[model samples]
Target: MKLILIRHGESEANFANYWTGWLDVDLTEKGVQQAREAGRRIKKANLAIDCAYESMLKRSIKTAQLVLEEAEASFVPEFKTWRLNERHYGALVGKNKTEMTQQFGKEQVQKWRRGFDEVPPLAKENYFDRRYDGFDRRLLPKGESLRMTSERVLTLWQDQIVPRLKSGQTVLVCGHGNSLRALIQYLEQIPVDKVDEIDVPNATPILYTFDSLLRIERRIEL
Candidate 1:
């Protein structure tokens, strides 16, 4: 089976160098173009996507739609889940990233951004929208370290993704940078400390071919 992973294209937050965890934001025109180009690249690779997954965020949802449309696989089943959403930045939400780096010092901000267990400062209130209404409020994140993101994300991976892959379905996961990183950390079994060195660029696609047992046979960037 083939599995493809792609981070959502640049958002307005990215353009402004801001932290936008759990903030609903739209993509810029450049971001839209980036997503389209990603689709074209996948089309060139001739990989037929059978099923797709995305986070609840529109940025991720739209990217998956565009990719499947571009790859001529628009009819594929698409799934969206809250667990696949971006890591919550808590009090860091809407703050400028560069300024945070300047104020907090590079080392500290880096820890919050990339460290496995370093959670950002918690938000004072729960600002989740109606979309999250059915979920238990206590389960919502105030802020999340990579470890926390992994715990929730991997639950969906184990429960939902593994089943389809085992059924011989080709899957496409379009997600945010940190969420995708958590998934990648699990898939590749990368050392947690070493994960800081990994960076997922916007709209770029990574393809993994798997054996019948779902073991990774090979990986390639499309």
Candidate 2:
């Protein structure tokens, strides 16, 4: 079985150099091209994905569509859920990273961004969104540390992704940096301290091949 994980192409927030947590934004022109190139890469690899998954966010959803379209596999099944959404940055949402560093000092901001258990200052309340109407209140977090994000992400992984892989199906997961990182950390058994160093670049695919027992046989950037 094969699983490919790709982060969405750079968003307006990413281009503007700001923190974006659940900040639904679309792709820029460069982002579109990047996504297309990612598709070409996958196509060249001759991967025949059976099922695809993405976050409800437009960036992720759009990236997945573009990938499949370019790969000439638009017919593949797609599943979108909030469970694949990025970690909530709380009050930091929309805040500029450089400016935050200036205000809070480098180390503190680094901890907030990379430390496993370091949660950011909480947001006032969950934003009203129809997509999350039936979501569990606890899962709709004010702010999430890596540990917090991992818990919910792992739950979805077990419930949705594992079974398909166990049946020898290929899967493509399109998501954000932290969400994919959480998944990668689990799949590769990355230690919390080192996991922060692993990045999911925009529109780049990381492919994982698995054995019958579902252990990763090989992982590479495609």
Candidate 3:
């Protein structure tokens, strides 16, 4: 089975150097081009994607749409789930990363950003977005550590993605940096402390070929 994981293209927040968290933002022009390039790369690799999955955010949703269109695989099944959204940054959502680092000290910011269990400060209130109306309110997080993000993401992978891969299906996942990192950590069996070293770049696809038992046979970046 084959699995392709792509982080969503750069968002306006990313271009502005702000912490995006769960905020909904559109792709910049360069981000759109990057998404197209990613699709073309997938096509050039001759990988047939059976289905695609993305987070509920528009940036991820748009990337998936653009990828399918560019790959001429628009007919493929697409799944969007909140479970794949970026790790909630809580009160830091709109803060500038550089300014935050200067104010809080680089080490402290690094701990909040990459530490396995160090969750950032909670948001003032729980999110009340209409898009998440149907989901359980308690499931929404005000803040999350990488470990917490991994738990929810792994649940979705085990329940939704693993079965498909086990049946020999090829899947494409367009998601955010932290969420994808969480998934990669699980798939690659990276140590908790070592996960801090993993960084998923924007609009790049990480392709994985799996054996019958779902062990990774090979991993390639495109």
Candidate 4:
């Protein structure tokens, strides 16, 4: 079994330096080209992609579609789940990073961005915070830290991805950087502190192979 993890291409928010968690934005023109290039590259590699999963987000969906087109495997099953969205930056959606740094100070911003357990204050639009809206906010609520993100992704792996791998299905996941980072952190057994250092470039894919017992054979950048 093999699992391929990919990040979506550069989004307009990426060019604008805005926090885009659950914002439902689309890919930019350059992003489209990048997606095509990613597709072409994946096609050239000729990996046996059996099935796929993506975030409900459009950029990831589009990237997955483009990659599948390149791979000539558009007929494969593709599942979308909100569990794979990027780390939601509370109260920072649509804000400019440079301006944010000027106002909040770079150190504080960096802590919020890169710290493993530190989650930013909740978004003003708590309605947008689907993870914690109506389900007893005081107890067993869910907005995610990077650590929490890892936990969620690992649960998804255990419940969804791993079973398919054990069944000898080659799966692909197209997800956000932080979400995918969370997955990689667990998949590779990397330490919490070092997880943030794993830079997942846009549209880049990470491939992992598994043996009969579902232990990882190797993880490679493809």
Candidate 5:
């Protein structure tokens, strides 16, 4: 089985250096190019993608579309779910990371950003977005630690992605940084404290090949 994971390209908030958790934002021009490049890379590697997955957010969805178009794999089935969205930053959404560091000390902000169990402050009110109308309100979180993000993503992997892989399908996942990180953590079995060291660059693909028993045979980056 093969799994390919790509983080969505740069967003407006990314350009502005702000936290954009759960915010719907479009990709920048360079981001579009990056997505296309990722697809081209996949083609060059001669990997036959059978299915794709993405988050509900526009940036991820758009990246998946662009990638499929460039790869000429639009016929592949693509699934979108909120479970792949970025970790909710709560009140920190839209706040500049550097400014937040100044406001709450560098160490504190670092913990909130990278610590597996360190959840930030919750949002004052729940956002009533129509994109999530059909989902259970309880499933929507105001804030989440990396551990929390991993739990939800793991559910999707176990229930949806793993079965597809077991059927000998090559799956592509276009998602956000934190969400992709969560998946990587599971794939690599990285320790909780060590997860902080893992960084998923935007629009880059991480390819994994698994044996019949689901043990990793190889990991490649493209």
Candidate 6:
């Protein structure tokens, strides 16, 4: 079975260089162009996807839709799951990255951005704080480290995604940077410390094929 993973296109937040976590912003013109290109690339590759999955966020949904449309396969089965959403950046949802770098120092911001087990502190009762309400209250209140994100993603994979893969379905997962990283960690069995080093760029599709034994036979960055 083969699985294709994709990241959403650029967003307004991406253009403004702000933190976008559960912000629900739409894609920019450049983002749409990127998605269109992704669609073209996928179509050219002649990959026939059987199943599609995306984050609840519209950015991922739009990307999936455009890609499928370009591939002439929009009629395929697809589902959405909150488990595939971006890593919640807590209090820093709309904060300016430059200002954050100036205030907290670039090193600190970088640490929070890329640290495997560390999480930025949540805002004190704000929009970003409330975004986690749907999740387990206890886990939400405490905030989530990337390690924790990986654990949650693993739960979803073991309980849901793996079953579909075991049934010989080719899956396409559209999601954000950190959440996708979590999925990669689960699929590739990468050490938590090194997970941040895998840079999955915006709108790029990664394809992985597994043998009947469920071992990876090919992993291609398409």
Off by over 4 Å in 2: none
- Candidate 1 local lDDT, 168-194, one digit each (tens): 888999989999999999999999999
Winner on lDDT (3 vs 6): 3
Candidate 5 local accuracy as lDDT?
A: 0.93
List model 6 lDDT by residue over 31-129, tens digit each: 888887887887888888777888778898998998888888899988877677777777887899999999999889987887887888786754434
Candidate 5 residues 1-222, lDDT tens each? 999999998888889899999999899999999999999999999988999999999999999989888888999999999999999999999899999999999999999989999999999977758888999999889999999999999999999999999999999999999999998998899999899899999999899999998899999898
Better of 4 and 5 by lDDT: 5
Q: How do all models score by TM-score?
A: 0.97, 0.97, 0.98, 0.90, 0.98, 0.90
lDDT at residue 188 of model 5 (Cα atoms): 93
Question: Residue-pair clashes per candidate, as listed?
Answer: 0, 0, 0, 0, 0, 0
What is the lDDT, from 0 to 100, of the residue 17 in candidate 2?
Answer: 91
lDDT of 3 by residue, 1-222 (tens): 999999999899999999998999999999999999999999999988899999999999999989888888999999999889999999999899999999999999999999999999999897557999998888899999999999999999999999999888889999999999999999999999999899899999899999998899999998
Residue 137 in model 3: lDDT: 85
lDDT of 2 by residue, 106-178 (tens): 9999898888889999999878578878877775889999889889888889998999999889999999999
Clashing pairs for model 4 are none
Q: List the residue pairs that clash in candidate 5.
A: none
Q: How accurate is candidate 1 locally (lDDT)?
A: 0.92
Candidates 2 and 6 compared: the better one by lDDT is: 2
Query: Listing every candidate in turn, what is its Cα RMSD in Å to the true structure after a full C-alpha superposition?
Result: 0.9, 1.0, 0.8, 2.9, 0.7, 2.4
TM-score of 2: 0.97
Q: Measure candidate 6: CA RMSD.
A: 2.4
Candidate 5 ranges with C-alpha deviation above 4 Å = none
Q: How many steric clashes does model 6 contain?
A: 0
Task: For candidate 4, report its TM-score.
Answer: 0.90
